[model samples]
Target: MKRALEKLGCAPVLEAADGIAAQEVLCRHADVALVLTDITMPRMDGLELLRWGREAVPGAVWIVLSGVETFDSAVAAIRLGAFDFLPKSPHSEELAVAVRNALERRQLLAERERLYLELQRKVHELEQTSEALRRDLQRAEVIQRALLPHSPPPMEGYCIQAVYRPGQHVGGDLYDVVRLGERHLAFYLADATGHGVTSAMLSVLFKQRLVLVDATSGLPLSPAAVLDAVNRSICEAHAAPGLFLTAVFGLLDTSNASLTVASAGHPPVLHLRAGRETRLVRRTGPALGLAHDAQYHEEHLQIAAGDRILLYTDGLVPSGTERDLHRLQQVLAEQRSSVQDILAQLHDAAQGAERDDVTVLLLDAHAGASWFDNGAEGRAAAASRAPRTEQDVVFYGEADEAAWLALRGRATWMQSDVFHETGQAVLAAQRPLVLDLSACEFMDSTCLGTVHELVARGGVTLVGVAPGVHALFEELSMGDVLATVRRDAPAAPELYAIGAGSSQAAVQQRILQAHEALSSLSTRNREEFRDVVESLRGDQQAGGGHG
Candidate 1:
């Protein structure tokens, strides 16, 4: 029968002695798409083989041959997923037609399976591509956020508020406030030409090129010169066609209470005076990166007490709105409560519909008290009545070239004030300052603030810090900021041990509170001591019962 089937157009036909051998042949050759077996055979019958083949290879077609033309056997074979059942004495024409139909059905199913696998492969590739793009956008947003200042740099006698919000994942708007000299502060807000990666990259490049000093003059550049230099830089360095930026730069002379501003086709800024009156400050200059050697003019305004200056980009205004200057003036006039309150109102007005980056800077001339002013005469008057203790003596001595400031006992709020007063001279002196903390056993948050003040002034080194004292610095994440050298022996063994008449729990509680204050320095510091901070906090809440 196999030879006959081959002669009838089945090439390379396989022959099996019984149903078991036929099943074995199907297992060995995966390409065998068709199976023919007799109904009654040795070792595993055709009916069993049909069941196995249907489950093992559903894509293969099966045909059964029987000498006895019993309706029961034919029905049984058909129920086992047999494609066809033929009598043993069937004609060649019938066999050829059955084989032809079975082969055609098998080919169609195989083609469908191949197409389904290809579709699955394409879907997996698309998912991976989408994940990569999402990660890239997330990283871009982080880079852009890091470029902004975490906090305003220390500026004396001025109150500045800056607000920045991006419409999309990233934007092309940026503002920078730089201290150009001892009494001069230069601030600029720039909006690049486009959005997303291209514009963000340009903004970063512009910031790098826009230095505080002019390359030609070497001195701190004026507001007009800074803008002119930036204009030339954009034109020379950036070759991208049609690339340009609109910016406004302001140089503030805090000493004279005056401001000089220059513009490069940016929006007009609003100035609010003491009597609830608003005036527009404007300067006409070509937008940057458009023309080489673009000239700019500076407008000087004498800032008065209780006066406010508003700066913003065009994105603050919704598109299709009237360009009437009165609308903007009214918005700034009505929202005069606080810087944060004004920004809140503007954000509410936008209602998540902003199409571009929004940046607003408000500088209020409050003539506020100076940061360094602590009313030394009043403190001196009070100090004369109260007996001075050795604990309050923060100033130690003046060494060869470096002045030494040591903390003998508890460095709390009083010690902090003493350091601020006596240490001010050390900070101003030409010699280096060395902070000796060997005898210092404890410090509160106020003392840490004084430490930060000294470090900010520069040329201050810490020496002889023990583990208990050093824990406070490490907890505040100031370990890297202050240079400290530990002594061979613990600075103060009494700090770590129970006092002669005091309880150990009381001492530990004080140490824990100081560490808690240190942990409150920043969010990252809190995370670094999460476990220890939580455990110590739980112990404190339990009345120092836990060790």
Candidate 2:
């Protein structure tokens, strides 16, 4: 670089005596621009000197000095990376010009080197960023896949299909088809508060809670129970605040030709029967988390052979479409075709473009009573088929709170009660609990206070809930204290009909159990159905304020 600078009209070159002396001079002034050497010298010839310069001083601009033609020698120097070659007996002006040209070439080479280094640095930086994004995407894919059912149970008489489309790196929509032994299946579609990681996270928590119901509950949990628990969890704990889920939890009873469903502040569901007859089931509960005591109700509808019950999220309801009751009637009346036909027609009616996340789960029940062995042996085989990453216990309804508290007094579990019986069950719970409100249509401060008391006592995990009631808790500031509850059951029943065994005595026992469950429901012990209604009204008022 210095040699090039001197040739740009800066300095002079020092001449040396012999080849050895020249070598020493070259070493001493390594940064010098020009290497002017004579082809014939005392100890070293110009060609030999040129070779030494090529080995030792590669960066310098060289000018060969030879009395002979030196053309071949010059070519050799050039090949050795010399910038330019000159004759020894050249005119003074020519010699000076040659030196200047050599330095000029050196300067150009130096500039090119700088540009190359800068480009390499940029390319390396871009590679690192790309690698980081790749890692993030892989992680996202893993998380999204985990949210889906590993393998939904094969529902007798029905084939199931589930599709997920994530707009960004993650999605907040989810669906599940769980097989609850006895040839029964439970299906649900839920959407979280919003898009992106946080929304996706909340939804995931909700899903885990649904599948992770406390094995200690000692009772076969129903769909209404699941929704109520989910609601209570969100209303009380780690669930979204301004956010809530619009979802449906349904049961497909293959043998009975019936479908039972409970809605949590979601779009109305459409039912397509065998005669091309259609009916729309409207949502009965506030959106999950809206009210601390929002109570979700389940409706049982009978279906003939070939009846198709279509359940979907609000994305197809077309926000404005569901605001009016008429839209539901329209959906039912126009179901002139099959389940697929109704789903498409509903989407078209929903104004597809304003679309939110759309999801549809269809249940088909064909002719005559289709009964599988569903015997103890088949149940045992299914149970032992594979080892689950997560394991949970099943509780019968007859179980008392002591059994539940003993099993999970310390672990986080959300407490929820949507049905009139559930509140009594909560009272029966001895452990501190996280409450769920996904199924409750009502709840008040009294219910909220009890929930708080439970939180103060033991560990809790809350999930699924609505916004209005969520705000109330925010107002009272109890929202942060609730952790969250999750359910892990594969199949949950929505509508429960407790019929006696055979004898009149058995019938009496069934009636007695129902009465006991209902009688036990009281604010003095546990908040009852009244508390749920009250909670819901308060939530509506709170929501109205925001609207």
Candidate 3:
């Protein structure tokens, strides 16, 4: 058998006397690939050796041979994991075939085991790499969060609040409210184009370059000029296609409640008047990094008592639709509690909808207080001040007939309930109600929503709508009601005051009803105001009103 295996080029074939001797050879030569054994050998049989060899030298293949082979012996040898079973004294050609087959089987098994070990090593390496990446991301997330403001700066006669929620461990939304000088406050909200490490790095660059003062002149830049500078910096630093950011910057003159705001492809700044209609300070320039010389425009307006300016990233409203903006406006108008509560509500809404990185900054002007003094004495004096008796609405006719209601000065939520009560009474009595806005300088969201409710019903007319008031209507997408507007109306007479005093419950109900009326105008309005309406309903039930 050894001579025949050698002829088949099986080199250095070692001979064993019996199964026990074969075991000794296999134990010594751990690299042995093939074993030929006689089933009936002394000390230990081929089957026993085959079983022991399988456990000791698992890679070796076995071939059993016997001159007087019994069917049972051949079966035992084959069942013991022998590669081949052949009779003793067979032809050299037959033996060569068996040895060749056994060696080939051993080679295949060794190669398979080698590949498996290699695969296991690769899997371990991948797991380590994945864990390293996870740790890096966690560290990045902490750094990014640290860059955000912990709280807004304290300002006299004003309340500032902010909320930032990143969609991922790292996000691209950033906001800051910094005091530019003794009398000026600068606030901004910026959003990079995407969400990830790259976008986050770009947002960091934006923060670093958001210079409020001119480097050369050492003078504070205007809101528009600041945006222009930011845009130029980004355009120069990052010329990559599809990379950009939207931002809104505002500079406030703390002394006179004047606000100058500019936007670069960002969401409109929400101007929420306490108890009045909300207005949008629209965007005025292209997105930053889009053009090297993009010019931005600024809008200047005087902030009033109980007024708030809301700046947010697009992540707050992922859809970026007219309806979505209206919804946010409605939320601001409805949530007249504290700035913190408003931010919480907005953040919850954004999170519930699974939005991207969301950031909201609110600036509120305190009512009836001096910007220079927000001390306890000032607050006590403000609390002790008499309620305003200046009539904002004057009725000229009876409720049973055509009634003329002249809205004087700024018709806001403080007086919206009075007008709302009179308008409803007149409308309910099947009488004609005419609203005179010729003397009205401004009408807030509450009053506008009240007017919307009255107009939605029949027998209402609006005359002498001022350009600003007309623009408000257009912005709310209530242009259809503008069809009832006339160039002029007859002079009103016998004016009677619609008093603006009401219980807390009545005021809450009025605000709720006004927003409900606005919500009924369109499907989008309904969706946007749905939560506000439900919340109002709960508040009304709980005897709770805006703080």
Candidate 4:
């Protein structure tokens, strides 16, 4: 039998005298693929060997053979997990077919086992990766929460409230209420273009770059100017197509309850008065980062006692319909209780599953505040205490020596005369000009352009530059020039005054020169100020002045 099997290409077949011997041989040769055995054996029967071998070599295939084949014996052998049972001394062709079929079965079982183990390994690896991603998202959500305000700053006779709810682990809505100097309170709400980590990152950049106070001036910027500056910055550095933000910024003068608001493609702000009609502060410009030269217009309103202003993201009204907005307005108008209660009512009113981030900021004026009445008498009282405008420009040191030019108060187009006269005088003397902006509260685009012109002429240094101003310069692509400038302490000496009072033609000339200088700084500046420069030139020619 062994010779026959070897002749059929089954090599190195081990022979055993009985089932017991077969067990011993099988134990020693664990790598055996197929087992051919007889139904009757000496020490142990084939059925017993088959059962024992099944456990020892689970992957091996078994076939039974007997000299006197019986139906009962064949059934017993087959029940014990044998692949085939045949009479002993069978045809050579039948023996070959049985052995071949059994070996093929063995190969299939081995492959099945391999694939099962591999599937388990891959599933385990996927589970580990999923767990790590979950942990990372948790950390990111914590950091995003930290960027939000824990509590609003205290203001007399006013109540400020904010609520933020992200639909996912992290969201794209951001809001901040910052106190600018002593009198102005600035607040804004921004919503990025999309959801998830990318949008969250964009919102963070907006928060970092939003300049509430002017760097050159120590005072707060107007709402429109604040939005315009932020838009210009986003357009210059981070403008990706289809990526923009909707925002509304407001500046509140606490002394007289005057609120100036500006919006960029944002939902209208709801103004709820105590007993009058609810008003909407609507958008004045396109969304941020859409256009470099987009202009924002300001809307000024008086906040009376017991009035409330609600600023929210579109998530608060996902439907974005007139009925939904009216419902929100009705809720704000009816809910005269605490801001928290109003927010809860608003949330309850929101229908369907939340698909976006929801953010709401509420400003409430307390009842019976005498200062809330923004009448002419109140304005007169506030004006009486307002600081008088000081000399904006003063020059120190003689023309021959290195000179210092100080800018105080608000520097705008009105100060172009002083800037032109002093700048020309310093250039004629061939002296290095050091500009002092320590006491300056604000600088308009015209003034910034004039400063740019002086820098272009060479030998110019800017000192006491505030962080906001530095960011502005960098956004306008003036960082290379500013990088070489040095900071130095101003010297106290005789001050020479240059009045801003000048002819219309001279003022037009200064505006043109300043814008032209700014336009030369960057391509974006050139595109932005091109119209203003051309318009001024046209005006100059019409007035018979040199263009």
Candidate 5:
């Protein structure tokens, strides 16, 4: 048997006296491809051997040989998973052919097992790689959101709203609405050449280098000068080649209601007035970083009260048509709601099919004098227009020494005027302010800004806060900005310290709190608030302040 097996290319053919010994032989050789055994043996027979081999070495093939050619024994051997069966005393040619067929079948099974294992290993590696990429994208999204403004500047008679949606986890669209002073309002919108991590990084660097005011004189820079400085910064940097930026820089003067804008290869800014008329301010020069010395020109418009301006990136409208501006303006004019409501309408109209980063900034000019100069009159006007129910009136009268203010309905831009007045009054009185917000169903950016401003003055606690309002504060990470006690909770003891001693230290603490809030807001907020805090500190140092 061994000699015949060797002739069929079975090198070093192994032999055993019985089935038990043959099982030991197979155990010693893991690479054994085929097995040939007789049906009847000493202790363990071929049928038992076949059953054990079928369970232990599933990828190997087996063939049986028996001199007792009984139909029952042959059927049992075949059922025990033998590849082929033949008589024990057979021709050498037949034995060689059977061994060849068994070896070929074994080789195919081994190859299939190897391929399946390799596939499983590769799938595991891909899952690990995908998990790592997902974490990276989440970190990038957090960084991008941190770069945006926390809340609009607390300026009077000018309402600003912004919406940003990146096509990926992070994108290249950026916008800022900052107040340079009491009279000058500055805003800028920029879009890089592409989206995702590369473009998002470029936008962050651009935001850091784009100077809004002269460092030495503290004067607001011109729209053209701002763009020129940004252009030079982009051109001189070590950015990727073929990358460029399109932007519109604008300044609004509250004194004359004039707006001066400078554009660099960006789409035109949309101007919509109360009468439903639309106008477009076209681009003045090529995109930034494309040229070493790109000169930009400025366009001036005599903006009226109630005039609306829309500044956006290219993704807000289609690239092919100029009439998209008109359509957008018509949509804007049709909505008489707040800025956030208008943005919701526009977002739904798009059906979230934005392929690039979309950024939109809407500014509405309110017809009123600055709250800094006419706080009492503004308070009266706001109070007259505010719709009050019996519950609101009762909530307002809950004050002993603390000033109680109840907010009702949606706290949107329309409520901002009253909020500013209420904030100023509470600050000037130097009393504890207890705010009742249980009746307020919603809040917008302007209302949130007002809340921040009021809390910055110290000695403020919120009572009767609804769950939605509480969750909003938590979402913005401003839960610790002020104390909020639910209606069921016991009243806080600090609410009774309106005209108490240690008022001087409390005022100083409030100033410190304001500084902390400013630090938490954004980089621009920290920079702008620096001067205000310093001025207040300077007055205190000179003994001309209440503290």
Candidate 6:
């Protein structure tokens, strides 16, 4: 039967040929487009041959030759990704058309493969670039972390807990507890204007200048003075375009009982007392880097034991509307119910997720407890001496010899820095050190405020204060400018009556209630009553008590 077909010029069908041989021939020869094979084979069948040929040969076409015209065979050929199936009695033109169509389809598919490979190559290149950029960003983050202080500086009589989170990989928020000397603890939290790494750069710039001012001025610069000087320097440095800083700078005297704070365009600082009440402190100056003379307010906070001072950037408020911000303050207050409670609140607030660059600094005014922060042992020592406020020092822009001499004469106890190691050395000596201002001319209000805080918080006395520094003091008053100054500085020259000014009459009444509560308390609840009284007194005095 096969010979008869062969005599009619038909090729002898090798029905038992294995799929491997069929595949090899299809791949090896460029001209072999049509696949002619029997359904049943020794090793592999005709359907397997068709599928293999279709994949291996870019433009290969398949035609199955079957002895039986069964539906199952036809279905199997299609299932194997095979081309057209033919019976033994198929017409010539039909065969020709099927073969032509398959060849055309394979050609179209070959072009598609080429385009896909090209697309894959481009995609790989894009992925490589993205990876490189990610690496670069990671490197930048490392450098930024290196620049920040490893641990919060130590103070003699205070416990400070601060949580700083950058909104992005690098944020503009900057906080550092600088030890100007043994007695002075200078800590500042600064938030640059706007967002992104540009703001962070400004923060970096402010820190560098702050350190520079401490070194060169040789003065016991207060928090206000530092803010003023830093603000001016930043303004001058970035005055070219739009740049500013909303910041808070504090100078604490752990040995004494005063905290001097200065604010520049930051949010109103909160003073949380034990009475389950909170007060907003509006200090002045201006944000750093705004303008050369942008004013900042300074306030004194008297602290004893069991009191807290909360310092934060504006991200906590989300715009001061409603009580969202105040709620955060309340949360802070209740958390102090215990350490465990505080930790829980902190964990929830910052489960490593920050809405913005939310930063919080809590100063435990009650000097008994010690704080382990940022790898540093933070302690605030309570001086067993009388209170003292800011002394006098001339503002210097550039270094000068004559001004330096005047500062030396004016201030017996000079302070430079107390938060960092170098600042610690400059400020620690118990002597009435004279600060050098020969290299400084322009001064920032934060430095002035810091000096004030030291005087109020520590036992250092504020003597021979220059009138020039007074203007900055008056400008940052929330109300009762004189009252604020006096209360902030324990070493104030003269004491004023509690209700001296008519403007503060109501304020004095409330204040008297608090003070009387403290002064008239009996021995039984002295500690408990004293805590509330001291806190209330501090709140009312905003000007008198030193930390």
Q: Please list the Cα RMSD from the true structure of every candidate, rounded to 1 decimal place.
A: 18.4, 22.5, 27.2, 24.1, 17.7, 27.6
Candidate 5 — which pairs collide? none
lDDT of 4 at 331: 79
Task: Identify the superior model by lDDT, candidate 4 or candidate 5.
Answer: 4
What TM-score would you give candidate 4 relative to the actual structure? 0.62
Ranking by lDDT: 4, 3, 5, 1, 2, 6
lDDT of 6 by residue, 253-301 (tens): 7677677888887787778777757767775765677577677668888
Per-residue CA lDDT of model 4 for 53-87, tens digit only, reads: 99998878898887664658878878878999778
Score every model by TM-score: 0.58, 0.41, 0.62, 0.62, 0.63, 0.50
lDDT-better candidate, 1 vs 2: 1
Model 1 lDDT tens row, 125-180: 78756754554553355456546654565676677777776656577888877776
Question: Which regions of candidate 3 are displaced past 4 Å?
Answer: 66-70, 73-80, 87-101, 337-355, 367-547
Better of 2 and 4 by lDDT: 4
What local lDDT does model 2 show for residue 404? 18
Candidate 2: global Cα-lDDT?
A: 0.55
Candidate 2, run of 10 with poorest lDDT: 400-409
Error of 4 at 108 (Å): 3.1
Best by lDDT: 4
